[model samples]
Target chain A: MEDVKVFGLWSSPFTQRVIWALKLKGVSYEYYGEDLANKSNMLLKYNPIYKKVPVFVHNGKPLAESMVIVEYIEETWSQMPLLSQDAYERSNVRFWSKFIEDKSMQMMEFFVYDGERQERAIKETLETLRVIENQSGLNEKMFIGGNTIGLADIALGWVAHTLPVMEEIVGVKFITTDAFPNLHSWVKNFLEIPAVKNNLPPHELLVEYYREKRKVFLAMAFHHHHRH
Target chain B: MEDVKVFGLWSSPFTQRVIWALKLKGVSYEYYGEDLANKSNMLLKYNPIYKKVPVFVHNGKPLAESMVIVEYIEETWSQMPLLSQDAYERSNVRFWSKFIEDKSMQMMEFFVYDGERQERAIKETLETLRVIENQSGLNEKMFIGGNTIGLADIALGWVAHTLPVMEEIVGVKFITTDAFPNLHSWVKNFLEIPAVKNNLPPHELLVEYYREKRKVFLAMAFHHHHRH
Candidate 1:
């Protein structure tokens, strides 16, 4: 009895990464949609450190962190390999994956604040995007690491679906053909994958969710600025 | 016919991690000490994104990031496994490794700054340590993951050696017998390892180097504060 489970929030890109990986690997597991405002006891029990969503459990053992869970899923199930068979190629994929994962939170700065800070954040985000465009092997291959969608693609999965929502909310465009042509194409290619295409949360719902969340973030930022 | 080379700095904890992993696996390689002030063209070509140290080259293909290189070493050579053969245990080790790696820079904030910032940073560092001491499986096992030294140990290896130097320079102590007994013991166990003990940079030189670096950091901080 293969008892696998994922505790996640639907609109979260982190959560979606795990869901998409599971789907890609054809692993059927129970899904528990977590309410972040009021987290479940199971989540708290599973991940005492972070207590964040995308906690993957197999049999009785639990795992946290989206990319970690995705890697676990890939390793546990042999079908639909996300990383390459070659050690060097696998390391290359991991290098890009770590790069994007480390920057994932910082890349959302544009949507979280406004005015001069937003402009600065936008520049930083673009700088990171530019690095991805130029250095991440996107020109030679369709995906970030290689021709096929792999770990780097999954690590960067949020940009395809959630980044557009953030872009719309912030009213600033990134990943355009003129600015980041390679990323623009890679984004299209990533979304076209059946596992990714089918597993995404509804676009309108995501936009609405993030729009409200952005308002909260801006309000907190305003309060923080005033307090300082 | 094996070709393995490491481009690294002697004192950098990140670079030391790769070196220690190699030593632990008994994989001998040529080491090139990089001067951060004037990084080599090879380092630039190998890791253009960060232009950083600890670039591991195996058969001419270069890999960047300390933990990433460590993982590559673990995969390439299976002699003394840094991770568990069991999937769940490996994920657990990864979780703690990721946690420590993410907080590694932030934990150094106490050493980087002074006054109120240092206090706050110290508190943050203590909080992180508390989490590790209480939550991580250190109570049951001799190391972070299990009885043997593994990836998490290598990931948190800096804390064992370098943190003491930072503490000595800054005149503050963490991981004491009273504060973090588990980590205190873990530190003792980590240092006892042949790979770790033999591969460490000389202590007095490290202290002198960091003392100089800290002065520069403080000066930069003073200038930035005045400018703002």
Candidate 2:
């Protein structure tokens, strides 16, 4: 048996990215749900730098960062290819994957924030979605890269799960069929994947978790905005 | 002959990354100096997404984003391998490379800004350097991954070149022999690479360019900071 263990938070979209990739590759691993408030010493030891959850340990070697771990999984297990065989094609997909990874944090900020800052975050989020709609080849393909599910789709997997929860909490809808036709269709295709579909956290649990988080975040933001 | 062309600003560290990679591969190309104030139609056409410099064109195909372009160059011309051959090793180097890429913009911010923001940026830059000095394999090896100058080194090449210039303008010096002994040594190792040595922009010119840019940046930051 492979000695694979993962320290993660069930509700974290970042952790879910790793879960989906591992499942897609049919790689078996033991999962540990961590309390973010009191993260385990092992989690701190495994990732001294970030000290966050989703630490993927394979045969005792630890790796942190979700996309990095996902790429590592792709390399370690060739059973299901997350990227392309051709270099040009691979670079193209990597570009989109990196793009999504870079944008994900800012894109999700609105849900946690409120007032003018949330409005700014919403505007930036729409701009990011608009760029993808106008620039990415989603009109021609099912996924971000091509007809098949790939790394970019995996990188974007969080949007399907987290974005909606955020939208509900903030009372704003971003991905309408009219504004983002391709993304609407792409989200449907992404969620249809068994690996992605099966591994997501229960919606009610996630709403509860983020609802509490949003309160803390807004309290912090309120103090920050009013600072003299 | 391979039809390779590069759209770049002579002062851009990102553009220099592409140049160093090309030189290492012994590839020939035409270099176009872009007036960033007024970008050419060709540059805009080649890279419509960001419309930034370091737009690399090879055999009529255009690739943007410096690291993305560098990876493409690595794939296209296998003469000078920027990455390790083994999958695990490649992932390791790429992990560091991505880490650096994510932090690059913030690291460069202090040089362009003034007041408390610059102090914060300086602190962060030192923290970043401290992490690399302690975490990266500099005590055992000359470069980031190993003795050989690889992709991570190339991605970090700007720090070796542009950082000093920024320091000169900002009246602060980082990467001293005492403060960062390993990085101090690594800087010597990186600069010794013939490709890197041969391709840097004239220092006086970069100082002049960045001095002008710093003035503009501080002015914008001043206005941004005072906004109601």
Top candidate, metric lDDT:
1
Q: What are the per-residue Cα lDDT tens digits for candidate 2 across A1-228?
A: 679899999899999999999999998899998998899999999988889988999888788889889989998898879888887778888888888999999998898687788899999999999988877789999998789889999998888888998888878999989999999999999999999888889898888989999999989888877794
lDDT tens string, model 2, B66-131? 999999999889997888887667877887898899899999999878888899999999999998
Residue B157 of candidate 1: its Cα lDDT? 95
Please state the Cα-based DockQ of model 1 relative to the true two-chain complex.
0.90
Q: What's the DockQ for every one of the candidates? A: 0.90, 0.66
- lDDT, candidate 1, A1-228, per-residue tens: 999989999998999999899999888999999999899999999988888998999998899999999888888898989988988889889989999999999999989999999999999999999999998989999986678889889999999999999998888889999999999999999999999999999999999999999989999999999997
Q: Which regions of candidate 1 are displaced past 4 Å?
A: none
Give the winner by TM-score: 1
Report the Cα lDDT for candidate 2: 0.90
